[model samples]
Target: MSSSNKIQKKTKSIDATKKLAEKIKKQALLKQKELQKSSNQDADADADNSTTHTALSKATSTSPVSSTVDPDAQLKFNTFAELKLVPDLLEAIQQLKYTKPTPIQSEAIPYALEGKDIIGLAVTGSGKTAAFAIPILQSLWHAQTPYFGLILAPTRELAFQIKETFDALGSTMGLRSVCIVGGMDMMDQARDLMRKPHIIVATPGRIMDHLEHTKGFNLKNMKYLVMDEADRLLDMDFGPVLDKILKVIPAKRTTYLFSATMTNKIEKLQRASLNNPVKVSVSTKYQTADNLIQSMMLVNDGYKNTILIHLLNEFMGKSTIVFTRTVAHAQRTALLARILGFNAVPLHGQLSQAQRLGSLNKFKSGTVNILVATDVAARGLDIPSVDLVINYDVPTDSKSYIHRVGRTARAGRSGKSISLITQYDLEMYLRIEQALDKKLPKEDKPAREILDALHIHVDKATAEAIRQTKEIHDKRGNGRRRKNYDDDREEK
Candidate 1:
């Protein structure tokens, strides 16, 4: 073989090896380019994800309104439709003339509808009742079971008011509710319970009484438990009673705790009763409604009554609630108003249940333009037409002041609260102002002519109120237990 032929074969082998290496190198470059492209795509996706997250965060946390606009005002909801409530509830809301959900309702209804426990902080008349009620009714309207929900309110009036709301909202669904409050007969309540009502609205004390004494009556099947005016309910020392009720009911249940303000007791109650709850607060700062006009008129203690009479004259023919510190004061004030030719009635714990209901009816029906009440009427009574709330006496605490003034300016209607502040009430007035986070407007005292004109009726009214109050006490005493002939004769 020639040396040139052998070299050529070796060169051919080397050429083949080079060609294979070039092909391999080209494949590797292509693969590298593909991997780089994939990495770039992933980086683009990460950037997109970051952009999405930031946009969502902005949407949820930031409002489009101007910086000068109220931040809380951005929480407004336009209609009940947006909350996805069922037709029945929407119909009831329409029939009740409620066009939109209040802030508390809008924030709370969804969580409640999702079957979550809730801690709602909103003032009265913010539609907290409907917030919980609509969900409870929606959940339980189809159930054949009895006593599906139990609501504990701080006062009997509030209990009744809650029951009324439930009945009104659930009217088309044939829902039945029993209000177990003290002023009513226990036997009657027991009878109502026998009917297996869907809801039980009761004050803690009366409910505890019925739960302990009533035979075969229990809330073992209660699917929901709601504490309305939760601060006052817990602050009133209903813990033991609430615990007993909780123990009796099913452990798996939804609980709603609503309050005008948060307190340590309410927090403890949350720990005890509510599961992991969504906190929906419309007003974190202690503040009244936007429409409430609160004012204070400084006057001498002796002139307080005269000023009240004049104010009543000024606002006559409009419904007013006069808050007094004592039952006797409420009675005296009402009697005085009545003697002044104003339609007035007295409401306090001391009044018989019949008397209390009568007074409330008169005030609500426009039969009487004025209701003189102690703190018993403060918390959750929903009288919508009250044009003014007169603090005939300064409230003992800021919460009381809030509740008393809350009687008017309800359901978004504008109203006024004029407090009669004497020199003795200066400290309390200041405390209320501090709690409100704003000072009340100062108003000029009534004119001399106004006082002088009303002064003519004061003496006659005072004497008649005193006599009628005595008669009321006598009637109550006589009704409670029969007095012996000798005792009656001695009293006479």
Candidate 2:
């Protein structure tokens, strides 16, 4: 072709792309307006007009139900029984006391049951697991086959949580599911695979290991594939691994990809994985649940710990999660809390698999009311009773901030999140506010005498925590060195 012709063709292609982009933008705006109108109607009908105040001065609040319900299909069906679910599944849901479906479930379940690929966009704790699991289980009831579905999660805790949901929902149906993730016994997982369970919930890396090494454990016949927390999965650099998995799974399978936000990366993955998928998005942008009371405290760097202790004491007897940026900080904070006479536990990646699960169990069972954790516990682990979330360190990004605070105010429950902002965190905190499109209310500072009194106990606890942490590190180092020395001596 002539050079002029080539230039004309390129210009035409660019114009076409611009038109498509504009079309999508217009559609999104329409959806946003519709959702907003519906929310207003619901609020007018069922909202409580009372005000509640806590130790913190009057904080901003909204109706919890308004934030979670998507008017699409939700107004049509009010209960699980109205959704035309199978009798056995309906019985299980009723027994579990799940009366209503959240917006995600209300919208996605119908399309999923129709055997179409889906792209679900909702914040964390919006009942996404059941949205996908119900359709898969309903289909499995008709066709009982092993290795029928594969669910991938960004973290091990989320993968296990998804498996728990499957087990609970499918209890009456004799459904079999297995969770495969890193930091566990591969040989044991291999043995479980030998049993040929119906569903496999796993993190990307470990499942890839099994696919490569475990004989007779291929997803050749898998019918349903779910990528939960798809953005986080790719953010953790699982793109290449996911590409390989996609190539191996059958092309005709139903795929459901769920995420809190849609970046360029998520868009690309959606195109590559889902086939003509129906998109169901209940949230507009980076948004927290309306029931979540968010506030921040600007503190001096030296007084962050003292202020954190003060907040914890004020919220005593409430189930809480204290989020830190680093594993070391999480460990130290939990140690400090315990020393100060609070029942606390730490959850982070550095602990063994058993230890991590133990920490989660303790917090869930109310054996410990406070859990100090890194972002590992942020995304999709649902403990519905979580009443408070404390950001001991401001998250580096807005997305992490959304997930960290999402730990509370789940499933239409009222909860609170407080971010402890220091001088160094001001810039990042501002960025988070920009993303949320709203300013968080500044928490009233406690009396100076209150902090001064707590400082004495905090100082002693901090010193003791540092000493204990150092001793633990030394013991681990000595154990490693001793093993190496013994190996060398044996070789000699």
Candidate 3:
């Protein structure tokens, strides 16, 4: 073909694509209006008999008002039923035994159902996932369109967890959702995308890869965009990638930005992405759950490992996570735990995607009762029944400390966190206490004779673990090992 003919052909294709996108958007809008009409009719029919419907009607009467829902805000809707969720969602919630909405859920869901942009600020494990998932699924139920929602998570683990939530909640609705994350095969993900799922839960980096490299996949007509863990996403320098994604997706879509803390970067992101969003904050500052029992153990650096073993022994047969600051620490700690006869595993970013998932499954399924993890496991992961969180290494910052401990004591469950405070960690620990506005009480030390006796076994285990780790590193070769063994900093 001649140059002019080729140019004209390309232009025609572009025009056709735009027109198709417009058609899809119109159809989605029309379906949504119909769903709204049906919902209103149902509400009117049951309003006299349903106090829940009356409350929901009053809550959503305004045009997506912008206001903060404090932790103590009188909850407008207590139960999922009172939130006026569709019967399908209500049934799923009932099956899941979710009797009442968490504060964040009760505050955010009603506005989200009203098609409003939202800035949801809540700590980890406050039912933030369900807060956003319920509304998105409800919208998907009404519209039934492919690629109806796109949820961006910070880590691959979080992406998969979010997909699981969507699948479970939308089970009765026959929901088709795919998780697009790194560490999995690209071709497999491409095939999943070809299936045209209703929701795409993904980490920003991998999703951006698909958007750029994968043919026949895009989010141009996606109706809902949820940036879960917005602060962590920005902290990982996903702002540039998020900007690119925001450019491609339709601006008319509803957006929900949920974060633990609203930093300057998050505020900037909100301004750039959300439009007149209602800000719902369940907790205004850095705080752990009230149900969490936090204490500190002052230890000498030489005996830190022994103290860790001592605590693990006390909490034996219970689900616990040991938080380390480095990949090597996590690996060696898990090895040490196993040497001393603890059912333990390690999870960090250094492991291949398969290994990471395997470790998580082992911990989640009770195959392993202990997980030694880096900061990677601290945020946005919903691991239930964590009886204790042990801070093997004091987190570098208060925010990180909060997230690490947040892994336990979730959803009103009682849990405990013990931080090992060395002389070096005292300054950092004090900063954390200042951030929380309360000093943590000192944990009673075990009898000296017990610790002295335990030290012998721990020292032997430590020596064996170090030797094994060194051998493994040597086999991998120094240069390659160094390249791959960086701390668990970025998700993928």
Say which candidate scores most in lDDT. Answer: 3
Off by over 4 Å in 2: 1-74, 478-492
Which candidate number has the best TM-score? Answer: 3
Better of 2 and 3 by lDDT: 3
lDDT, candidate 3, 133-209, per-residue tens: 99999888889999999999888888889999999999999999999886678899999999999999988877888
Ranking of models by TM-score: 3, 2, 1
Select the stronger candidate by TM-score from 1 and 3.
3
lDDT tens readout by residue for model 2, 1-492: 999999999999999999999999999999999999999987865544432234223454322112234634435456888767778888899888988888888877878888988888887788999989999999999989999999999887888899999999999999999999877788999999999999999888788889999988899999999999888887776878899999999998999988877677877887788776888888866988988999999999898899999999999999999999987899899999999999999997767667889999999999999999999898989999999999999989999999999999999999999999999999999999999988999999899998999898898999999888777657768665465333222111
lDDT of each: 0.81, 0.86, 0.88
Number of the candidate with higher lDDT, 1 or 3: 3
Q: Quickly count the clashes in candidate 2.
A: 0
Question: Between 1 and 2, whose TM-score is larger?
Answer: 2
Clashing pairs in 2: none
Q: Estimate each model's TM-score.
A: 0.80, 0.83, 0.84
Q: Compared to the true structure, candidate 1 yields what TM-score?
A: 0.80
